[model samples]
Target chain A: MIHAIRARIKQGHRTTRYPDEPMTLPERFRGYPRLDAGACQDGCTKCAEACPFGAISCKPSLSLDMGKCLFCTNCIEACPKGAITFTNDGRLAANTRDGLVVGPDTERVLARALDNKMLSLFGRSMKFREVSAGGCNACEADTNVLSTIGWDLGRFGISFVASPRHADGLWVTGPVSGNMLEALRLTYEAIPAPKLVVACGACAINGGPYIGSPDVCDGVDWTLPVDLYIPGCPPHPLTILDGLLRLLGRIPEK
Target chain B: MTSTMRTFRNGSALPLGDVPVLETESFLKAILDATVHGWRVSSYFGLPRGGGLRIYCLMSSDSRGSLGMAAADVAGNAFPSIAEFCPQIQMFEREVAEQFGVVFEDSPWPKPVRFERRLTDRTAAGCRTGRPSDVGVMEYYQVKGHEVHEVAVGPVHAGIIEPGHFRFQCYGEQVLHLEISLGYQHRGVERLVLGGPHPASLHQMETVAGDTTIGHGLAYAMVIEALSGTMAPARAHALRGVALELERLANHTGDLGAIAGDVGYLPTASFCGRIRGDFLNMTAELCGSRFGRGMVVPGGVGFDCGPELAETLLKKSAAARTDLANAVELLWETPSVMARLENTGPLTAEAARELGLVGPAARACGVNMDVRRDHTFGIYSMAQIPVATASTGDVHARTLVRWLEAEKSLYFIDEQLRHLPGGACMGKSNGLAGEHIAVALTEGWRGEVCHVAVTDDAGRFARYKVVDPSFHNWPGLAMALRGQQISDFPLCNKSFNLSYCGFDL
Candidate 1:
């Protein structure tokens, strides 16, 4: 007990003051992409050509899909005019799938808050049933990290429930694998009506790197209605929280 | 029938013709002969070759520090089964049968490995009809008698873990037999990787098993580099070493914490999870992603650890080491934690060897075969990290082994950062040689991650096979459940936290 007490003292208070204050991510941590069409020169398709997942389109004007991007920095690395640049800002979640597609003038694609009725249902407290359809476990892990002392997501009345029956919504990760597709449907059906769904990664949003794999669906939206789309290879824990908070109307709209 | 098998070093490529193409009789005999002399099957898969199927077998000889490779052309289903004789090859053979739609005459369990659509044309594009049938519906081994009940758990579990079905035949509280059926996470990596894995290959590889981003990423990178005759710069290798160790630190720390939490020890669980995140942040400091996703590229690392970054990492590593020791040592000091962990979910050393377990689990059972130490690759060849092992094959031994390895990983990171080579970290990988086969193995935190790539005439990936550590260790988990109380299943499962997607891939 002495040892335990000493350890707790050393651990201290780790929960970060995120959403209130901006989460401090590393410099190298590429998040929301800032695209400047003015910066782009004519006939420049380096960014598009460099993109592996076709996350970028450089036809008439350059548009980037946050849902489809892995943030590998190939577009930025290959862009000669510096038209596309990734910022340290980690908040890159959106409410609508179309909102994830950012044009040159776009800034942060933050998730829009839910309507008053929906907010009344889940704004104060929301329990999510995490479903890993075909997730690589990275998204599942980052979601778990939120429950730890560092993130303390439960402070905001947010948590992952053990059963779909008890959950307010489903927090889905991974491009839905075929075998899991059936199970995911069953789990979703088990949840009550008017349930929300948050696709928590690029895989869940647009299949990330596995967009065309026959064994997996394109994304979570293929099978279920996603209320919020958090995008990344595995979105940073802070990014995930931002999406959830914004969706619940907990984080006030700018 | 050729008796000679082409022996190659880890992450090295060999000409397709250089590998001994033996008759089925000779191939079986060769695999059997080598296993008798302590050789283990590292990778074995069937490939569609010229109107017939060819089975390629790779055997790892730890003592010799080389992998023996051989191939046999089976005309039809005429290939005899060797899994009944060698239990180690059981999973690989079963996988081969599942993938190619061939029958293994005497396979102990010829069940679906990942439930991915077989390569056969009939089931190819299983999702073409826009309906995927439910997996894990196969018949499970039963213990038929009164007082013997069956408990089926998950493709969707109570926790946030990935999907995998576990069937436990329990007599009262004690588990009689545990059979695991997986493949809910299968995203069909092997099928997708065929043809040309152009620009998306690296990202796809990184997600092969997402938590093991560094492990699978590095293995895929090595395979590409080997096939293309590319050598990463000295600095890149050292940086990769740093990233790999950080991944190990993060996972091992998290697993230790999870183990403690399962046993109702909150102090260690609460602190270690945070400490694990710290290690992940360190990796993010090196690269952009916490999982070290973009850090490793084919030719070299996409990101480099400069002097300033290295210094910061070193400081963080030292801090996390101290923090980890403080949190974890309580588990050792407390009687309850120790009692619960020791002898609970015990797997005998013999069982571990027979099942061919790898990584910390194998080390816990005193089977010392780490890819880093045994079949050294990357910067491991330069600075050897000593293999951590324990004699007891229980939850306690597994936990302690992780602790020891976590210490070693921190030390290794410290050493690498202090003396990181100052040079270019990125290079160009040459075009892959057209008719070549490459094999790469990396000891991920979980265990050995094996990637075998065979190129077509145009130097594109024709057959890409991945054997995640979970493939070798999942059976070990089932074996560990035997005679254990059903309540302790969570603790035992946590002890060997195998990757679902990696195995499903």
Candidate 2:
């Protein structure tokens, strides 16, 4: 056991120095959805059809509501432009509600607007209790890995609690199910006031392939109001790590 | 014994019995009688376009492997019920009744068995009334006792796991009866296999259950190959075996880590998790998928096992084996883990047999059944593997079995790679005509994965039935949970690692 611990320590710091330097993501990590207008046809509506969360729309032109987006990458995957690159640049936040927008090519426009919003501010910490509505456990695996000895996310005062009652934030993943709808409501109600709900992964933000299932609900927002949405099929561990830090106000809004 | 393939060239056979083609009532009785005689019903075939509802029952000991065939014309009978003899058939029968309205006489439980009853009503807007009926409302057993409070846990849980609901009838933590409700992760994969794409689109068949991708993919490819009389090249076959063994090793290592973690053995969990990560990284190096994706394509592999990837895999496997051995040894020194897992969730030999449990779950209980060893497929026949088994059916035994098997898989992969012949990796996969029905059974990490597929005149998928290992082992879970404390549930549950999505679909 001592040898194993020594081996891990000898491997050096495997954790990313996120606050000090830019974090490098894996090659194929699902970060956020990007819109490619050039590759999309004038009324193809493929993106909208592909979205289980109704995250994409083409009525007035392409529009995306990141708040509602599940980050499933299905829209980007279906986009013929070779247009979408899985980039890990989600640092968008706002004090006012109107900052959220929707429309075709909005991701490109928001990309520039959010660039200045990455303000690096540190503040109070909060506890998160994760729930897998109907996830494949990929996101859950990544969630647990973030808190290992290396990342030491607890140092940021960002911790995953065992129960929702003591939690300041409810971290939800997977597509909500018909049977779980009641349990979800009870959990949200059990938590104290000033509580927040963050929908993680494509399944939680949107149903993904399980959208039309008779057993599952649409998404977290469809059941309860969501405070933040981190989209990805199974978002990269670093993406989730960053998202949680941002929620705690420790991450700066650049 | 050599088995000859039954050529269903004209039309696939249905359950055979006395029935007026138009009368749904007598037809239902005929099918029920067949099922009661120990006949394993394979697939339920419904042709809304052809005004047909059929159940194909294949008798295992029958001559020429003939499938007793029977059909009920739903156009003549509005409702059909066959829930009495084969209660399990309610799902399929109700599906047919909701969609096609073939009424069966004297069904013990008669209600819409698949869809929402009110919505599936014949006059509902845009609802397809030509298919079977909807799902019936779930019935709860009545108990006369002290209040009998019910506590429901999940669709979502506090831990890192899939969605499933455990409704416990308890009196202050001491549970009375535990009822499990699942299906939260249903993705309609079987329906996706039909109409919208060609049979070649079966490439995604592996991804249905991400962790068991290689196993399912191999089974799907084998079914296609069997139907079309195609054989993958020797090199591809070797590569497939290599992928399968790697998959088994990765899963077993990770599961062993989790099992240790559940008992609060952090040293083993941390070390094994890291080792398992190395295994996954090796997989990513070999195939684009970190979880063995795109390794098994129909007819053969899409990519060859190049020297560089094979060499990298070999090095990684060696390192993983060394790390795991040392970690497990350290874990053995810790008495706390042993105290928690040693004799928990014991499944005796008799109970194991009665439940028909397969793979590691059965092996851990001394049943000694493994599809790879019993009825070999791919290169396993040539690999000449001895079945892994343990007499004690506890969590500890399962963990030991996994550890032992991980080493075996690593050995198998090394042997396969060394003797891998130099040759082509693919073959022709075209011309799937006649009533081509084929089945492929493989030993996935979980257990036996059986896939049966039938092609129509136009070569479209007439019916496809996928049976994951979880289907048979789920009953085993209910048995294992018996007389055990609620806290031990996680340890017992992790021992099986049953895939929720695999069974949901």
Candidate 3:
């Protein structure tokens, strides 16, 4: 016990001061994509051609669906005109499905908090049950990282419940594989009424890399009525936390 | 026995016609002879050919540090099962049966590996059997005795983990049998990569098991490189080595913490948890994403590590090493933690060998096999990291082996960063050569990740096979559970921590 205490003391505090104080992520850390449609050379479709998933649409002015983007910067690299760039603005989440799509003129989409009813009910404490439909475990790992000492998501009274009965919503991850379809639905059904669904990661939002694969149901939107959409190949824990807080009206909307 | 077995180096791409496609009897005989003479089946899959299924077996001879490829045409959708003689190929046989409708005659537990939908549709050109059904609903081996209670847990588990069903047949508290039923996370990864290396193929490989992005990505890149006959730049090789080791460092650190958490050892659990993130952040510092996702690409790495970044990484890794040592040392010193880990979920060396377990799980049983050392490739061929092993095949042994391996990986990453080669990180990958079969192997944090690609006459992927270490070690996890307490299941499970999706894919 003494040794344990000493070790703890030697380690010191390792938690990040996010929301309270600005957290400085690595400069290379990719988050929201910034698109400059005016810069596109005439008849150039390099960005769209470069995208593994058809996340970028260039026929009409530049538009990128965050839900479909892997943030791999393939589009940026392929763009000969420098029309696309990834800004380290990790605050990319939304309440509606269509809101995740960024038009050329739109600066960025910030996740809006729930309406008055949900805000009053779940603003203080929101418990979620994470269901990994077919996630590669990256999203699941990042989601679990929220509970670690560094993140301490519990400070906001947000916690991942063991059972659906104890949850206010379902935190869905993965591409919702055909095999896991029934279980994922059953898990959502087990949650109490007035429950919200937060689709986490690119797979849960738009099937991510496995978008057109016949084995997956594309995203959680196909199964459940998602209340919030957090986008990333596997959304950073900070992004997930920010999204959750924004949904609860704990963090101010941009 | 060695005379008949055709051999190739680790990353060599051979003409498809050159691989010996012997008679069914000779193929089976060759495989059996090779196995008896100390070789292990690396990959076994079926490729559709002229309205028939061609079964290919890639065997690795660890002693010779060479790989052998052999094939046989399945006559009328049925082939004799060599699984009974060589238990290691049991899962592979089951996979071939399910995927291509080839019957493994007289094989034990001949059931669908991943109760996948559209097996008939996918295998329409070849032999087809087994209709799609609900996942995890299969005939499981039951224990029949007084007070033998059966407990089924998950396809939806309690923790924030991937889904898989675990059924325990217990006599009171002690488990008589434990059968793991997976396929919940199957997304048809193998079928998706057929025909050509689509723009999405690299991304698919990276997410084959999200945590194993570097390992799988490296294997896929090597596949493309071998087929295209393009070698990555020296700097790229050095960068890949760094990324692979960083991935190992992150995961092994996380697993150590998870093991501690399973045993309810809080201090080490909390500290290691944060420390694991520190390693991940170092990786993020390398290529942006914490998981090292976009870092590795075909022909070379996506990102370059310059001198300044290398210095930062070196310093961060040093601090992480200190933090990790301080945190994990608690696991060894704490008597309560040791009591839960030591001798819990023990699998004997013979069982591990028979099951063909890989990675730390195999090393825990003192099998002494690491692809980096045994089947050398890339930077590993130039600089070797010592394989760490422990005689006790218990949970403690697995934990200790991981700790030791993490230490070695830290040393490797530090060395590579200090002496990073100077050059362009990527080389131009040309169109693949026609009628070629290439095999690429990487030592992922979990174990040996093997990817084999057979190109058609048009230089497109005819058949691509991925063998994640989880495919081999999941059986070892089941074996480890035998005669152990049911309550200790989580700890034992954590000790192995096999990938469900990787196996499902």
Q: DockQ, per-model, please?
A: 0.74, 0.21, 0.60
TM-score of chain A of each: 0.97, 0.75, 0.97
- Please, what are the lDDT tens digits per residue for candidate 2 over residues A136-241? 5555665766676546687786778877787876878767644445556777888777677877765677565455444456577766777666655455565676
Off by over 4 Å in 2: A1-124, A148-152, A177-182, A210-231, A246-254, B1-52, B57-137, B141-152, B169-176, B196-207, B224-236, B293-295, B302-305, B381-385, B416-434
Kindly give the stretch of ten consecutive residues in candidate 3 chain B with the minimal lDDT sum. Answer: B124-133
For candidate 3, write residues B1-505 as lDDT tens digits: 4566568999889988888888999999999988888788899998888889899999998888989988899999799998888989999999988887788889987977888753436543211112334788779999898888999999888999999998999999999999889999998898888887999999999999999999999999999999998989999998999999999999999999999999999998899889999988998998999989889888898888888899999999999999999999988999999999999999888888788888899999988899999999899988899999999999999999999999999999989998988879999889999899999999999999999999999999888999999999998999888889999999999999999999998
lDDT of 3 by residue, A1-254 (tens): 89899999999997889988875788799987777889988888888899989998886688998889999978888988788898888888888889989987985567888899988999998999999999999999999999999999899998998899999999999998888888888999999999999999999998999987878878989658999999998888888888888889998865
Candidate 2 Cα deviation (angstroms), residue B408? 1.7
Q: For this target, which candidate reaches the highest DockQ against the unseen true structure?
A: 1
lDDT values of the candidates?
Answer: 0.88, 0.62, 0.89
TM-score of each: 0.98, 0.74, 0.98
In model 3, where do residues sit more than 4 Å from their true spots?
B118-133
Report the C-alpha displacement of residue B237, candidate 2, in angstroms: 3.8
* Per-residue accuracy of model 1 over B160-237 as CA lDDT, tens digit each: 999989999999999999999988888878877788667888888888888899999999999989988898999999
> Can you tell me which runs of candidate 1 are displaced by over 4 Å?
A107-109, B1-3, B120-129
For candidate 3, the docking band is medium
